[model samples]
Target: MTYTTRADFMSGLREALGRNNIPDARDILIDFDQHFDGGAAAGESEADVCAKLGDVDEIVKQYISETDGRFTEAQKETPVQETVITDNEPEKNMNTGDFAQTAKEASAPEIKNERSGPSAGGIVGVIFMDIFLFSWTLITLLSLIISLYAVTIAFAASGIAIFVGAIMIAAVGAAGFISTGFAPISLIFCGIMMCAFGGMLVIASIAATRGFINLIIAVINLNARRFTGHNVCRKIGRKYREERD
Candidate 1:
């Protein structure tokens, strides 16, 4: 495998393993690097190497299973360490526990005040920054929506205009044929070609309009889902791509 391709595959596998909370992910990634290196040494293409390894999800599942097996084995093989306390050490253990509790309490106030000393100006600055970011995002989103609507409207209007123009051309062809006693075949042919071209333009525009409409609908649905605190767009996109593929 080429360096770039190997890196990409390893990166994806690492992310998949991390998302699944697999243990020793770095070690697994190191193992994968060695595998890729071996494959490259054998002069195999990246695709062929990856095919032998299987899909990222499948690899992550296998890793998870292996990790669980190792954990179980370790648990079974390891001896549990129990604190063997004699009767005389009870007071010592109690004193140690009390000392630890007191130390923890003493540190609590310092931790709490660590970030609680922000000045009034700092608080106001943070508030201003948050408001600025919110306004900027809102403006950007609104501009995008307006731009989409404008483009859709323009496309739909062009479609209607082209349809009307086709009708006019057909009308002129009929009138010319009647006035010329149907004598000029070229005129009739030219008119028919013009009408066809116009019809095609109208059809193309309609298709474009429909595409824009679908895009708008998708955008609206995405925004609605976001507003409702549902992050289903990613899932929907994945499903769509799966079906398309």
Candidate 2:
């Protein structure tokens, strides 16, 4: 079901856990509640948080499977043996061979399956790419954006100055204090055109700046995932797209 509010989402999760007979349902609900609070603090909506969490049934199934696996592992580690005592049989004592076998089993080394992360070569490659390629490209784009904003400001100031100067010239000419070599009306029109151009540049600069910022963020996230072995941004982007669709 689509959860539109925190209450609805939590209620559904709690109901699902209850139906599944989850022993730690209260603890699971508490974790989910904290997740909602964190999302709210980050300025996310309830619907968004729910979407990121995916379906309640799927979450319950995941927990059920994990709990079952834990139980299975525990059972394997502590196998049960039934002892039958009859009046016809005598108690058997442990021999030297049996004691030695038990001791050897007890002292045996345990081999664990460890998960390995990115190799040294892979880390070095990511570092090289970030330093030599991504860094320079981002720097160049930032510089260009700054220059565009500066030019936009310059154009706007120049336009306003030209417009005011034309008005002043016309006023002085009418008073016979100064000779107006060029038509003040034409100068005013030129000033208006410059202002319009500057306005257009302002819009373009804003769009370019946003695009540059997104690009930089993408590069940084990509490099981070390469070095850390966790694609956090990718997961977020995937969840966002899923919700949007």
Candidate 3:
């Protein structure tokens, strides 16, 4: 359901029309556009559409052959003039150069070959995601989630250990105070600080856990929306192009 090759094919067709001096080039292009759109709506990929259209060079030759008579007649009626080529027309020259560059970039195969991950095969990364191979975005987010969970577990364990230690210290202090009718200020202070530190650790653990959970939920929702939006747009664009063509 991808239309990666459509624009390249259209560009090549346009150039072919120009080379042949076709008078109704725009109309012909529109028809081709419609044909591609119709094919796409029928669940064909851009590569399939292009294959159906056949070779670009062959199509160009066919157009030139079909309109040879009209081209010859037009050339006879058009006046021949001596055009002076000069370096003074830098702006026009620059415009022509820019147009050529733009066309070259647009028709480059890399346009269709770009992947969603570090390696080639964007669609493969999505459909065949594995532990070793997947989208970079997914890998990075998953790593972050794993690290966050690891931190959360460590914090929770530390908090529980500290809390237990604090309870033991407080119980000792209470027992000594009851047995001897006196408790050392240092022991009481130490117990209170340990309990406070343990409580803070527990709170930090909870916060980290909640944050990691929310992040995972957000990532799932975001990826889902992005995938759905892309598909919807692709469908609408295919239909719109078919209608316009």
Candidate 4:
């Protein structure tokens, strides 16, 4: 009943709103304080004031019932989330309760992010990222294998082309000496076709090399992400927290 210190109010609020809450919980506390102060100034005893308002639990119910009860989009962004890794601990997936409980805890009576917007560490985003990384790794490995095969095939075809071209020119020379123009014409066409094929093989080989290079880059990026990605996401999270507050 004693309208004591801020801590006392906070304790009551915590019991009301719960431990896990978004940043909007802070705003709610501020509002509660203002309400209590107004009531006290209206000639009511401190105990009466407390009793009239009722238990912190009831207050929270009323608070939550409001249309815009608590929370802002900015505040809801990861107000409370922990990376729960079970070091090979049964590898269980998260259930709905985990999230609901987390939200309840994060919301403090003193301050809470009650925005009720999307989850900060959305399961959807996590799933998508997982899928992307897995697919990329698979693709990179496959492309590398294909690139090697392409290059080998090109080299083999180059060897065959050189041999055939040589034979064609020799045949054309013999035709000219025998006074027959048909053989030389056919040989010239064959030479052109062989050269075209060889050029296409070279192009395919080059393309494969480029694809392999891309695969290597993807792998490198994934490795470096453990460091860079952590800090970047942390910084972003902090910024959103401040905005919610």
Please write out the lDDT profile of model 2 over residues 173-202, one tens digit for every residue.
989987886788888988898899999999
Once superposed on the true structure, which residue ranges of model 2 sit more than 4 Å away at CA?
1-119, 179-182, 230-245
Q: Candidate 3, residues 1-245: lDDT per residue as tens digits?
A: 11348877876776666665665554556567777779979999889989878887787677767776656665534311111112122122222222222332333323323311233343333344333432464457557656765665665565556556656666776776534223444444555565566566557665644544443333332233334422111111122233222
Model 4 misplaced stretches (Cα beyond 4 Å)? 1-181, 228-245
Candidate 2 worst ten-residue window by lDDT: 106-115
Higher-scoring candidate on lDDT, 2 or 4: 2
Positional deviation of residue 67's Cα in model 4 after best superposition, in angstroms: 38
The whole-model lDDT of each prediction reads 0.48, 0.61, 0.49, 0.47
RMSD of each: 23.4, 23.9, 20.5, 17.0
**Using lDDT as the measure, which candidate wins?**
2
> Evaluated with TM-score, which candidate comes out highest?
2
Q: Candidate 3's C-alpha lDDT? A: 0.49
